[model samples]
Target: MTDKKTALVISAHAADFVWRAGGAIALHQELGYDVTVACLSFGERGESAKLWKQDGMTIERVKEARREEAQAAADALGVRDIRFLDLGDYPLRLDREAQDRVVDIIREVQPKWMMSHSKWDPYNTDHMNTTQFALECRMIAQAWGHNPGQKVLGAPQMYLFEPHQTEQMGWKPDTFLDITPVWEKKKAAIHCMQGQEHLWEFYTNVARNRANHFRRNSGGMAGGRKAEYAEGFESIFPQTVDELA
Candidate 1:
């Protein structure tokens, strides 16, 4: 077992982690956790509209650009590891082989916790599908019978990061994390995604708004902790604790 804590974030697209969980990633890294981000695809076919709009852009070129952007963002966030699965997107193909590959990653990381997209994303099936894939991979990692000799994974809380259009997606955030200390790190990472310039400010505003929720929930005006930025998440599993606060 490693001395340091670890975590894993399974992002559906190259930029998904930047938009949704950059704050969490940076904050965790700052707190001495080895955070690994696995991007299932570069979102080449479906999400690269601006790159595709360019006259001479080929699929390979778009993928290269997106991969660069993701790498830059990961660097900005101080990520310990960033893996690109290169699985084709626009309806991400998570075949049996893909599932086994992800299971291998899950066992390798042995994350204290895991993060992924919401359970429902009608606007983008890729996001929701990624969450389902995460669940399946987590299960496989825990099955000793499947991979005889490898270390069987322990129960790790799987956190679902906030998806776009929260209201429409039926994603209720049960956890609000104050990320004030690392907000700048997250902003820097967000800016690294030059391919999606429009979303830079959008996610910044999301952090600010989530901070408000954090404050209100922490304790209203009477005792709320002062926070400038935060992120929201929904846990897929019940947490076990010795005592309730």
Candidate 2:
């Protein structure tokens, strides 16, 4: 791996990182790589089910709670740079300006690897839209005239993460990352999302199952490792020797 390489995970909601790629973030940080999280929404709508059931749980209150949760999770993984785009929840809309903003962030961060939700997810409208925007922004950011600030950045490798309902959502995992050493850290990160405990549990199991799949593929190394966990991803661009080496 390259020194000072950065991994940027852009999500539709603040807590999406916890469910999708928390272990990957921890592993990157553990290996001395720079990791950043960019959230398009605070997840004010979808995550408020628990709090809304309680007394006085307004949308603003839910947003604040999610902010705190995301902060704590990021802190646990030693991540300092976190950005929330404040896009609407449920159905995330990315207009021209919103796309430009994403490009600008990519220009500034200049990450080597960028991860976002899979566009093929059928269940969540927000996830699919955000994924499409992220992919388009990545392309625009890499282009010469489209993003002037992106000059310093090499073309980034983009990966789409599995959604919560991978099988039901039709998310096919083409690549699996080993997160065995950072599984504990990933769990700790996930614990920060108090608003979505029920939802997070499902993802935790998904990670374990994906780890098992990797284990089987790796000739049982994944299963043999007790604390193993994995994140699945699908790549849009084919990785070349120059990108990896």
Candidate 3:
């Protein structure tokens, strides 16, 4: 699909985008796509265990802390436009108001493609809910009756980024992106998530393993390209191609 070279990422929590889709965001930004990240919540309740552990830390303080971390990560990934929905997490209040706000953003950006969490995640309902919410908003953005006059969105492929436990989440990646060129940028973004420092090394290893998959899928060891880092994505829609190579 073609548009004004724009993309959007719907993240359930503040750091979800950085952990799962950071490489894609950095690589696409270098390729000249204006990628915007919409964080549905600060993850203050569930994801910010470290920050919450601090003495005398209130929910508001935890939210602010995670917001700063998210902003820093966004900056590291060269994302100039990052929006925080500030919806309460642990159970996101995805009411009609939230859906309308997201629908507006989808129409405004008119992204060529979108990124979100896996379709199913029993471990974190927030992640899975965000994906459904994204699908709903995407559908609404394309409807002529939803909001009269706005440019309807095209059928952009929605990509689900890798989850923490892929096996349990039913996340099967069909696409592997060689993110070696922007791996440093992604690393920096990952590091910016101080609230989740324990995941830094884990995701770094995930990238390396995916890079190996990239080579294996591209070609055998005999003819594969040597990629040091990569990211995986599961496409939710069938790709429309003129020819199958």
Location of the lowest summed lDDT over 10 successive residues in candidate 2: 219-228
lDDT of 1 by residue, 1-245 (tens): 56769999999999999989999999999899999999999999988898888998999999999999999999999996999999999889999999999999999999999999999999999999999999999999999898899988999999999998999998999999999999888899999887788888889999999999999999979999999999999998998889998
Top lDDT: which candidate number? Answer: 3
lDDT of 2: 0.82
Enumerate residue pairs that collide in model 3.
Answer: none
Q: What is the per-residue lDDT of model 2 for residues 32-74, given as tens digits with 9 covering 90 to 100? A: 8788899999888875688778896788888888889999999
Q: Point out where model 1 deviates above 4 Å.
A: none
Candidate 2 local Cα displacement, residue 180, angstroms: 1.6
Deviating ranges (above 4 Å) for candidate 3? 1-3
Clashing pairs in 2: none
